[model samples]
Target chain A: MAKIELRGVVKRFGENTVCDGIDLDVSEGEMVCLIGSSGAGKSTLLRCINLLEPIEDGAIFLDGQDISVPGLDPQAVRARIGMVFQSFNLFPHKSALENALLAPRRVRGQSRADILPEVEALFARFGLADRMHNYPDQLSGGQQQRVAIVRALAMRPEVMLFDEITSALDPQLVGEVLDVLLTLKSEGITMVMATHEMGFAREAADKVCFLKDGRIIEEGPAAKLFDHPQHAETQAFLARALK
Target chain B: MPHQQTAGPTRRQIFEARQRRKSLVIASASTITVVVALIVLVPLAPGWSKVQQSFFNGAVLAKSFPKLLDAFMINVMIFAWSAPAIAVLGLLIALARDAKSPALFPLRIFGAAFTDIFRGVPVILTVYLIGFGIPGLGLPRPWNSPYIWGSLALVLTYSAYVAEIFRSGIDSVHKSQRAAALSLGLSERQVMQDVVLPQAVRNVVPAQMNMLIALQKDVSLLSFIGPVEIFRQAGVFKSLMANFTPYVGAAIIFLIVTIPATRYADYLMARQMRERS
Candidate 1:
């Protein structure tokens, strides 16, 4: 497991600053849920931790190692930290099993024979055994997202970052993907997720952080935050988002 | 299933069948009228017989056929050699154009310059320059051979067009796909090899097929530098016989090769569209 720490992480696109001097910590095996309105910078923070976006100011530490230094190889850091996107960007050219198998075979240098059984077990355990051979186009949105999760997990990542992984899924399909996350949490994988599912965050997240205007407005245990939000902004946001 | 098949032609189906037959009848009548009119009207023209004698003489065509076919082998030979070179060079140039690293950015400029020069120049001009220009040096027999220089010219110019087609194919893959690949712990090179290139090549097949047929036809343009290919041989036959029939025979040979290729390209494009939709 990995502990992720962000110290004054700032991200900008042109003149707009999306993540302004944000500080956050995710302990090992902890599930931290970032809740926010659109443009509140929750997703940007997650991307910063994954090193997908370059940080303008501040450092991200993966297991106490500062990974944000310029010229350092991003691949080494990325290999240990897996991310899933809201769009479920499964490669359209490959089958679900191949998508899960590609990274381990290439990056980790695991032979197909060495990795196949475990990867197959992942699919079977996630209830996707029959869909493994089907192409991404042939699968439903939820099945593809599960395969995306499986693809990430196949690498045996110490930390998993989920950037609104269920946002594009149908409402009926969202529960299946969320169930996979709960299972992962139970298995002791550290995770940070940007989500709009307040109920899931309240039920499953170890901590709930409410973000607004690129800053964390309030953060506490899920029950505490849901029951008695400290900030007026957090309360107002919750009133609108929880509806 | 058997019951559904047996109950197949409903009243609406019968009406649709009658409509189809009516349209077919109308289309056939109009097509036949257009064909008969062209056949009758062309023959009635005063100069038609002389035109036919010069352009379509059976004796001249028969005599030219054997020599033309033999000469045509040179064009086929040039195309065969140049195509693999173009495919390899084209992909390299396309990859060069897509270079993202700071150190490799110069290759992007080089790729752009390459495509600009080769695509901007007319095919014949490029063929002439490389074919005649290089041979004009006091090079030895093999180096001065038009066959070598001529094929080189085709490779350079067609590589430009093929590279652009490949670049467009690369652009069509969504950015999210790249992000997903990168996030999966694959390095940039691995992502391109595993994720990007396979899809790009498949996406560009129909367009690339059209380019191949074009390359096949343009191989004859090398004759200007004097390899005595089909087009040049046809000229030889025309002068020897004092009739244009040999040129007509050459056109028939070219059509025989290219028409099937064009139809195949169309079939590939249609199938791709169906699959995508």
Candidate 2:
């Protein structure tokens, strides 16, 4: 069974449907990238899997159990699947270290003493050791996004979601954040991300799903998907996206 | 000027400095004129001396000063006790207003009703209603004491204003922040206590400081229900001495407290704005 599975998931905002009968799978340690134009429901799809947006019709399953049932606690499911946002969303009032330490201590019921050394090590591993003492406002865009990633990792979640994490960074700063993702992939975390970085998606994604208007137009292994056009919509999106 | 060896004071700088001096002289002259006119013209009024004697009697002021200070301490005590209650209750009300759960709809309703009723009705009327109405129930001992009931009134009314201020502060926090916290698996309560309130409260400190200044003055409204704070004490002195100077003294005392607080609040506001920008 896939590690995270969505079966005909549907999401709507008022009159507009953002996720139209979506189906996807992320097996253990697989990196699946969702690539699409802006407002193509890529972010909303990721948000739904994280239970940030309640789906109108569909079941989300984790480890063969339906996780999207309305009464199931989102917090319990969320603790197992971490998500990073387009905006770093680091608490401005807290130091990077505190931001990383907060969720594990509060949600996972770990004492700060037990969580600190490991979280500090995660910061160091991400090349954020010196910057961890600074608040989010004090950090550069790349550094803040890295801290946000570390904050998600601190929960030690089984599955991780990235919602256009590098899209907010400057062009020059984008590489560092993408590099962090490569490291996470190599370390074998089950990861799914909605991304605008076509180069990174082509190079690093195990699976690439091309989405348009809330539906996946085409999906396959990253190499095949990028090297050959399987669908007209995918071909058109890639032409403009690559150009 | 362009060929000068040293850039010692450009011509424009010299002109600007001279203009600055000219404006300063004019400002000083105008201020002095206003001051001299007030000094000269005030006593020239037909009833000026009698008006001054009634409102500004130095003897009455001196006699009432110590006692007024004593009564003002009551105001301070009421303020000190009520301020904490207002803050805690106001925060709870704010959180209630922010309730997102369908089951918590009543709490949201209660929060909305509370702020509307207390903020809409005149504060003095609320004071009279609570201060007199509650005690009129004839509760035994301290419960019926106006000190207790009167401060309760202030807490209720000020808490409504404070709750609205707090709600604004909470609203100022971006929705994304809450999403970020919740995405971390934090329970709603944890998200609020840990993530949202800290930023919200910090954002509104200057506004709350203004509330504090208002509260300090409004504590004297308790005097109507018979707490004998500064306002009531002044009334006693006015009746006894048949002079209004005590009222003038009371105003001075209030200015002494509030003006410094007002300045400090402005300082905090400026520093916060600078930091945010």
Candidate 3:
């Protein structure tokens, strides 16, 4: 069984279908990047995987346990699969350390004494040692996103999802956040990111998925997907991107 | 030619002239008003000899002081009990309303209706009805504990307003924050307790404080329910002595309580606004 798997996933919002039928398998440490236009359902698909957005139809298995069932506690699934949002949803009232420590303390039932060292190490690794005492508003966009990433990492989730995490950052700050993601990638963290940064996608993703109209048009090795175009849409997309 | 020939009047001089005129008019009006008020109130202010005869005289104060203390103590008791109850109920109502749970709709409506109905009805009527009128229903006198009934009336009145304050506070929390917590795998309850409510509460501290002081002042209205609180004691003094000084003294006592609360509330509001800005 794959570390994370979504089979026949379909999500609908009111009258519109967002995710038609997404079938994907992520290995224990594969970093897959889903690249698509806004509203093409890449974010929706990621939410579905985390069970934040419930699917109208499908099964998502995290380590072979079906998590897509209606009655399945989304919280338990969330504990194992963490997501970093595009907006860096750090609890505004909490400091960076508390943001990282909340889930571990609440869901995992880890005491402060036990989780403090782990959280410190996570923050240190993310280069936020100076900011651990600062609240979200006190930190820069890049720093906030990095703390958000480490917050999820502190949960020690099996798979981490990044939904356009750096899209909200300034151009100058994006690179630092991307560097943190690259470091996480190198650390063998399994990640599925919906991102607009093509170069980062090509450089970091083990696979590149080109999503169009709520479905993946083409997906394969990142190098081949970028170099050899098999579809006209892919060619057109690359042509526009190249410009 | 020579100082560039300054305009008709220098702007500074003109502004100073206008300021002087405005200040002179304001001071004159204030003085006139004070003189008028003193002239009108002289009949009301007890003569010094009369006051000397009364002040610290046990006969005058003893008859009314216990009654005043009883009423005041009862008001204090009502506030002590109801303030926390209102805060909790209002907060829970706000949470339930924001939760958007289908089942909680009735609770939302009931909470809102209770607040509006109590707020809409005169507090005096509500107190009278609950205190004296409820016994006519052939049920246990609900307002038998005048403190309890009076407080219940006030809590009903204040909870809705407090709930709205809480609702606005909860709403002030960015929807993105809740989504972020949800994405972190927190259950809805965990999201509220750990993430949303704390920030919401912080954001509305001044407003909540305002409501608290408002409730404290409203505590005086409980005297209508028959507790003989401070105001009622003053009433007894007014009836017995045929003088207004007791009422004035009671007003001062009330000011002693409410003025600080209002000022502290204002201070908190100013500090919060400063922080926000």
Candidate 4:
């Protein structure tokens, strides 16, 4: 069974339909990369899977349970499907460790003492042990983004979603954040990401899905999709994206 | 070639020092001239002694100080009582105004109407309506006390303004913060209390402090409703002595209280800006 499944998912903002009847499936431990032009709804699709955007129609299934039904708790679904955004939204008032500790302490009803050991380990694992006390404003863009990822990981989510997470980093800093993703992948975490990093997607993704006008135009194994173009839209998108 | 180190100041450094000295001299000289002019002009004005006797008499000021202080304590008490109520009420109204749930549409409208009506009406009128109007209704003992009704009026008026400040502060927080918090599995209420309000409250501290200073002064308006605060005490002395020195004394007391508060607000704003930059 797929770890996460979306069948006929649709999202609209007022008169505009952003995610038009999308269907995708990610089996356990698979890294599916969504790639497209700026308005291709890749980010929207990733958000829908996390239940951040309520789908206008269709069902999202996580671990064979339908999560998109009306009145189902998005908060519960979101806890299982963690999301990291492009603009590293760490709470400025909180230090790095506090940001990482918030969800577990609140959502899981764990005391600070109970969660601290595990949170500290996650910080140490992410190379942020010394910087754990620093506030978001005190950290570098790269460090802040890494902290954001760790914050999501602290929830121990089953399926992780990344919405162009590295697009906002400096050229020199992007490598550090991507390296964190690589580490998470090695741990067998199920992941879906919308990315502009063609080179990273080609090298790191298990499956690459090309999207256009709110629909996935072509998808296959990473090497096959990146090296061999199957559709005219995919070819055009790649030509411009690679440039 | 060996670089030579000079014991004396460099030429550029000497020039900058001279520029600084010149500005200081000019500033002091101008300030002294203004002080001298005021001194010379003030006593020369017609009826200056009578004016002094009526408004600046040291003896009357001394006589009035203890009584006025006692009355001013009432104002302080009203302020101390109203501040927490205003803060909590304001934040609740602001959250209501920002609420997105369809179930809360009536509350949103109510919040909107509250801020608009209270902000539009002059505070003195609200004080009158509550302090006088409530008593005329003859509901109960506690409701009839000018202290209760007057403080209630100020709280109602100030909370509206503070709520607007809070709303703007909450709005100023980037939309991405909300998305980030919600995406972390936090319920909407948790997201607001944990993620949004902390940032919003920090952002508006300077504005909040300014409102608080305004509140300190507005508490004097309670005197009009017969609470016998600082302004009302000044009125009593003015009529009894047939002189205005007590009123001037009251004005000075208010300045003494509010000036430091204003300075503190400025300091907080400057520090917040420095931290952000």
Q: Point to the candidate with the largest DockQ.
A: 4
Write candidate 3's Cα lDDT for B1-277 as tens digits.
5668675988898999999999999999999999999768765776855664555445665566556655677667778899999988888767766656787788777766666776688867877777666545665555356776677777776777888888788888898888888877677888888888898898888888888877777888877767777887787788788766666666656677888888988898899888879
TM-score of chain B of 2: 0.94
User: What ranking of all candidate models by lDDT puts the best one first?
Assistant: 2, 1, 4, 3
RMSD of each: 2.9, 2.5, 6.0, 2.7
For model 3, the docking class works out as: medium
Candidate 3 lDDT, tens digit per residue, A100-169? 9988888888899998998999889888998999999999999999999999999998899999998999
Candidate 2 backbone collisions, by pair: none
lDDT (C-alpha, whole model) for all candidates: 0.93, 0.93, 0.84, 0.92
> Model 3, B216: alpha-carbon shift in Å?
1.9
Candidates ranked by TM-score:
1, 2, 4, 3
How far does residue A155 in candidate 4 sit from its true spot (Å)?
1.2
Model 3: how far residue A43 lies from native, Å = 1.1
The collision pairs in model 1 are: none
Worst 10 residues of 3 chain B by lDDT: B134-143
Instruction: Tell me the tens digit of each residue's lDDT in model 2 across A1-243.
Output: 999999999999999999899899889999999999998999999899889999999899999899999978999989989999999999999999999999999998899999889999999999999998998988999999999999999999999999999888999999999999999999999999999999999999999999888998889999999989799889888999899
The local lDDT score (0 to 100) that residue B243 gets in candidate 4 is 90
* Better structure of 2 and 4 per DockQ: 4
Q: What DockQ does each candidate score versus the true complex, computed on alpha carbons?
A: 0.74, 0.80, 0.57, 0.81
Which stretches in model 3 have alpha-carbon errors above 4 Å? B1-77, B95-113, B133-143, B245-249, B270-277
The runs of at least 3 residues in candidate 4 whose Cα sits more than 4 Å from the true structure, single-residue gaps closed, are B1-22, B101-105, B139-143
Poorest stretch of ten by lDDT in candidate 1 chain B: B1-10
Alpha carbon lDDT at B187, candidate 1: 91
